[model samples]
Target: MRLIPTEEQRELAATVRSFVAGRVPMARVREIAGSDEPYDRTAWTRLSSELGLAGLAVPEEHGGSGAGFGEVAAVLEELGAALAPVPYLSVAVAASLLVSLDAKDLLPGVASGEVVAVVARSDGPLPAGRIADRGAWVLEGVVERVPDGPSAGLLLVVASTGEGRRGVFAVEAGAPGLAVMPLTWFDTTRPMARVELGGVPARLLGESDSGAAIDRAADVASVLLAAEQLGGLRRCLDVIVEYAKLRVQFGRFVGSFQAVKHKLADMHCVLEQAESVVRYAVWAADEAPDELPEAAAFAASYLGRAYFQVARDHLLLHGGIGFTWEHDAHLYYKRAKADEVMFGAPRVHRARLAEALGLT
Candidate 1:
């Protein structure tokens, strides 16, 4: 498998990097972070209509370019670097799940970016009473911490029959008894919500038993989220290194010190290692599906801890300025911290990796 990105993929990354740098810079991100919506509508429109990024990896029949996940991963990295306040990752995860389930009706809307969807990664299946039966498909439960939940027009959940049967379900926006409360989270750039469904009607999107599909979705989410973290990690490395070069200490540049140089080198090594794992995970997503589980687990566990460490060093290396709320360093730190626990901590991922490798 090619761990290195193809030229086309590199171009895609550069294009997205340029677009985000010009349109949704750190200043714009800060503005969105302070708002309740926490996502840039205008930029989302442009990304959908102008760039067609929403459909980059979708099949042509589904109103997409029929590209691969590699392209999508590249775009995600750029978004992570800019800390763009958009629901791309959530949408990507939801759309990909729909695609695999062959939900023909919903894929078109998702690919065209007309239906914004987010996955509710609930820890357990909806209790027997929490979901109705006999073709009713009415759901009742609270899915806390749903990414982009407030902005999603559709919420996809994996619920079990409580008799061992599992299925993928969808709940439309404005459904009766459906409530989405925007959360005041640490990382406002990726806003979340507490979604409550009190007897809300839903539609089953796929087969009667969706255990494998649900597991695949988790692996997909892990790898994609790691992609975003990798981007943030790279940005931390860049900003910290630049600061070291410019800031003077004792009438000498901070970067010129041997100790500071070693620290920077260590961070660089971590960043490169993360990039390797993430790149391979993205490749495995499509080309080598069977290997994705192991790759995703490795990427998630490694990058989560790696990004947090680099982010912490990024802040400390900046001296007093990094700790200030006004500086962007703190924002990356928050993203790193939030991401580290996003999938129940790096140790959880390590355990998953071990299980997938048959070591447990």
Candidate 2:
């Protein structure tokens, strides 16, 4: 796999970085985080219509740019760095699942960002609902901690339909007996919600064995999420380093101290390692399909913890200011913790990695 990004990829990353910096600056991020709106719809619209980000990975026939996961990774990385409050991850995962299921009808809407789709899967011990059929598929039960659930227009639910069969069903938002309630979360940047399905009617996306598709989509999301984590890791390190260089202690730059230098070096090393793993995961998503499972697990397991560590250390390096709500450091730190548990906790992914390697 190519470790170095191509020129086009680099340009894509640069464009996303510039757009996010200009459009969703930290001030705007803070504003949206506290607002009642699920996210900044205007910015999201621009990301879709102007940047064509929503369709970055979808095929052209599906109204997407047909870009590979590498480009998607670039976009995600910038979004992570800026802590942009959007439903990109949720929508991307849904799109991937729909594509795998050959649900082309939904793809065009998702690609155009006209539809906000999210998957109601497990979020660290949260169980999915069971699917009941009454002439049509019906979903019953509650899905806890659905990322961007309250704002989504479409929901791809993973449900169990007796006889050990698992399926993925597409349910319209606000369907009869479906209630979406936003939850108070630590990471305000990415809001989550609870979805209550009381015999809600849903259309099955594909044939009965949708469990595999959900798992595959999760693997893809894991890789992309790791890329996002890497971006946050790099940004935290940069923030810490910049502060250390500017802040003075005892008439000398704090960064000149041996302890500070050593900490910064370690953070840089970790960031570099995480970047390499994320790059490999992205490449695996595009080229080496056989290696994707293991690579995704490894990236998620390793980068999740690595990014959290960097964010924590960045807070510490900033001294007392980092703990304050006004500081951006805490924001990245909160996102780090959130990302770690979003798909699965680091230990969960590590166990998956072990199972993949036959070490279990």
Candidate 3:
């Protein structure tokens, strides 16, 4: 598989970066994050529908660009760098889940960015949810910490079925007996909510045994998220380096000091390693599905640690300014810390990696 970006992918990444710079800069991020709104509707619509990014990985038959994960990863990276408060990651995860389930009917709206979907997490196999067929599929359960739950038009829930099997189900956000209550989270940039489904009509997708499908979705989510972490790490390095070069101490540039230089260098080393892992995972997502599990696990574990470390160092090196809420450093740091455990922590992923490699 080509780990290097092709010309088209390069253009796509550049365009996405430009869009982040022009539309979702830090000022806009703070505004949107601080507000009660789910996200920047205008910017998200333009990005998903106008730019057709929402369908970058959706098949053309389903109204998506028929592109692949590589392109999706590109957009994700840029969004990570900007800390753009959009539900693109949630949508992407849902798309991956749907694809694994071979459910293409929802792809049209998803590709068009007309329908926003987020995955609701359960503790484990049908942990606290049940599905019964009463002329129509109905779900009853409580899923907590659902990403983008408040803003999502649709929710893809992973629940245990009556057959003692795990399955994925879809429910409309406005469906009867469904309640999505927003939760106060550390990362204001990514919203979470608790969803209570009580006799809510839903659509069941995928086969009865959806374990593999769920794992695939998780793997894809991990790889893409790691790509995002890589972006955040890169941004942290950039900001810290820039600050070091400018900030003067005792009439000398801070970067010229040995201690500061070593810290920045260590961050850069981690950033470079993270870039490699994320890129390999991106390639495996499309070109080598068999390897995606291991690749994604590695990326997830490494980038989680890498981004948090760099973000921490970024804040520390910024002196007192970084500690203040006014600076963007804290935001990045929060995002990094939040992301580290968004899909289980680095330790969890390391265990997964070990299992995948038969090292357990």
Candidate 4:
């Protein structure tokens, strides 16, 4: 079967690419990164409200486009190529955990860009003091490294119960005892935070036995991240390709040299492999429930490492300018680093893969 995008899908990508270029250029990204909001509200509104991107994957009944993961992947590719700093991943992917659970009432606000939601996870056991004792399920605990949490209007906090049950709780952004503080991070475009929850009113999502569903949501997020990373790696390669053709070293373009040509060829090969895996991952996200985790793991592990290497290689090819803040290479470099660990790091996904295959 052909993995190429359909005509309509190509149109969708072109539209998103043009929109992002017009609304959020590299200069705009730099401006927002230097701002104090921690996240860009205007850009988020443009994407979610004007572009309808926030609702791309939600059902029609819930005020979304009723599109599938493939459509979302297309949009994410454009977003990644531009390194556009919006909360699409947090609101579209993480908050989607609620959507998959059939939580429709929350979608209108979320899709309309009136609310921002984030997912919080960690490697260790879910901490105590994170769950609220009140009838409404009060949440109290600190979540480290929450993406877009500082500006999120809603939070989907994941915690474990005394009996080792995994639970997802919905907490309003402004509720009492909910605090979001920005963290110093390697990637400045995607701001992360340390979230503190205390006596925060929350509603439990799905049944207490919904750990399987939570895993599914994470799978979706991972697949989407892989697709995003693929786009970023391709963009990095594009930059190197352009640089190679233009930069003359010893009276010849760098691309004419054997070593540079081989490097670029390898980059192309890596990207093509990642592209196929991401396509499969997105397709599995929509159609193959049982295979979702495996698809996600394969895409995440390969794309994550591949994109990181592409970023470094792009910089190496660019030489001095790549190291400067003024150059766009560093921006993509930081994005690759950040995307590598988005839903779950490549290492974590590999471990999960081992468990799934009974090799652990």
Candidate 5:
């Protein structure tokens, strides 16, 4: 499979990069981070209407652009680099799950960016919450650390039914007996919340034993998130490399120092390797479905740690200023840490990779 972007993909990436750079610069990101709102709805609308980013991966029959995951991956990289405070992952990934389950009725709203949905599954081995079917389906229990939960209009909950079957249920954001409590997390760019359901009414989206669809969606999200981390990692490396070239230290450019040069070289090498892994994962998402499981596992496990390390090194290379809250370095550092654990931690994915390879 081609691991590199085509000309059209390159143009798409450049367009998204430029758009994010102009619209959601670091200053704008800081503004959103300090605001009470989780993300800028106006910007999100613009992305949907102007760029059609919300429908990048949805089928044409579903009011989407009919693009593949490669295009989605390209856009995600820019979003990650700019730390654009939008629910692309929450919405797009959820739409993917619904599509996989043949729940096309929900695709129009999601593809139009009118509905923001998040899967209320925790970062655990099993699905969260217990489901009951008393005349109609109802969910009762708590799901913690749901990404963009407070801002979501819909929640795709994974629950175990009375028949001991795992299924996905759609719950309205403001349904009675449902409480969404916002949580303070490390990354302000991506907000999270705790969802507590007390017999909240829900509609079943997929059949029982559709837990595999959730797992597939998580794999898709993991690969896309790794692409985002790669972008942030590249940005950190770029900023540091430029700073080293210009920052004068002890009568010479810091970059001229042998130690600094070696560090920069090592960082570049790692960045290239990480890019290869991310691109391969994205390709698997589009072209090679059978390889996607293992590819996603490897990308999630490797890129998370690789990106975090690069972010840490970038901070160190920037000296004391990087440690300050005012510097962008700290922002990327926090994002790295949060993303490292978002889908699943590196160790968790590594275990999955091992199991997928039949080692466990």
Candidate 6:
């Protein structure tokens, strides 16, 4: 099957790329990355109100534009390409869980682009759930590193109450027992946080006993992340190709060299393969039930890691200038690295794939 994007999707991609270049320019990304708040509300509003990006993947029933993961993925790719600073992933993936599971009341602000929502999934060995005391739920645990936590108005935390209990909870960011502290992260385009939930009030989402909903949410997140990585990887190739054509070494354009040409060709091949995988994964996420896990696993383990490696390779091709703090290539590199382990590392995802395939 042909892997090229359809006219409409290409249009969508172009629109997103243009908007990011115009509105959240690279300079703005640098400014926010070095700032105390780091989150850009103006850029977020542009995505929500002007671009309708916040609702791209949300169902229509929840006041969203009623698009699917594929559409959302297309937009995310552009965001990654530009290293645009926005909370699209946290809202599209984390808050999407709430919307998908009939938790609509908690998401209109996010869908409308008025508030940012983030995920606080704990990294401890324990299972996931809310902590309750005296009949009132209180979140009291350490959520290792949460994305977009510093700017979010709501946090959907996945925690463990016991060995087998795992659940998703919605807690107001400013709730009495909650503390969100920004963590120094590698990817300035996306911020990370350490959450201290000490007796924070929470409301449970999805079925009381089943962890299926949370698993589905995770699957959606993994697939979307793969799409973002695809965009970043593609951009890295583009950056290298442009540089190779312009830069001269030994009194000849770098593109004239066989080694540079071979590397660019290899990068193109890897990016194309990853694009197809991400598209398939998004389709499986929306259509196939039993296949979702396998698709998500393939995306996380292969596409995600592959993209980061490609970005690093592209940077190396640029030499000393690529390593500088002012270079945009480093921004993409940081995001690519951060995305590799966002949902789960490649090794962890490969284990999941093995289990889904009945491979001991």
State each model's CA lDDT, in order: 0.87, 0.88, 0.87, 0.81, 0.87, 0.81
The TM-score that candidate 1 achieves is 0.97
lDDT of 5 by residue, 1-360 (tens): 688898888899899888887888889889988899889898899898888888888898998988998999888888888889898878878888888888898988889898887888865433344435556777788888898887799999888765556788899889998999989898888899998888788888778778678778888989989988998999999999999989998999999999999999999999999999999999998999889999999999999998999999999999888899889998999999999998878999999999999999
What is the alpha-carbon RMSD of candidate 5 to the true structure? Answer: 1.6
In terms of lDDT, model 5 sits at 0.87
TM-score of 2: 0.97
Estimate the TM-score of every prediction: 0.97, 0.97, 0.97, 0.95, 0.96, 0.94
- Candidate 1 overall lDDT versus native: 0.87
Q: Residues 42-142, candidate 2, lDDT per residue (tens digit)?
A: 99999999989998889999999988899888889889999987888788878888889999989999999999999988553333345455467777877
lDDT of 6 by residue, 1-360 (tens): 333456777798899998998988889989989888657788888889988888776677676888766678889899878778888887898656877668878667778877678777765653234546766566677887888888788888887756677777788878897888999898877889888877778887765543687788888889888888888898889889999999999999999999989988888889878988888888887668678889999889998778888989888999899999878878888788898888777999999999999996
Candidate 4's clash total is 2
lDDT of 4 by residue, 228-253 (tens): 78778988998899989999989999
lDDT of 6 at 18: 89
What lDDT would candidate 4 get against the real structure?
Answer: 0.81
**Per-prediction tally of clashes:** 0, 0, 1, 2, 0, 7
The positional error of residue 69 in candidate 3, measured at the CA in angstroms, is 0.7
Question: Which candidate comes out best when scored by lDDT?
Answer: 2
lDDT of 3 by residue, 1-360 (tens): 688878998899899999989998899999989999989999989998779999888888888888999899888888999999889999998987887788888888888889998888765435334445554677877887787888899899887775667788888878998999999999999888988888888777877568889988989999989988888889899989999999999999999999999998898889878888988999999989899999999998899888999999999999999999999999999899999988888998899899989998
Error of 2 at 276 (Å): 0.9
Model 6 regions more than 4 Å off: 1-6, 126-134, 161-163
**In model 4, where do residues sit more than 4 Å from their true spots?**
127-134
Model 5: lDDT of residue 357: 100
RMSD of 3: 1.4
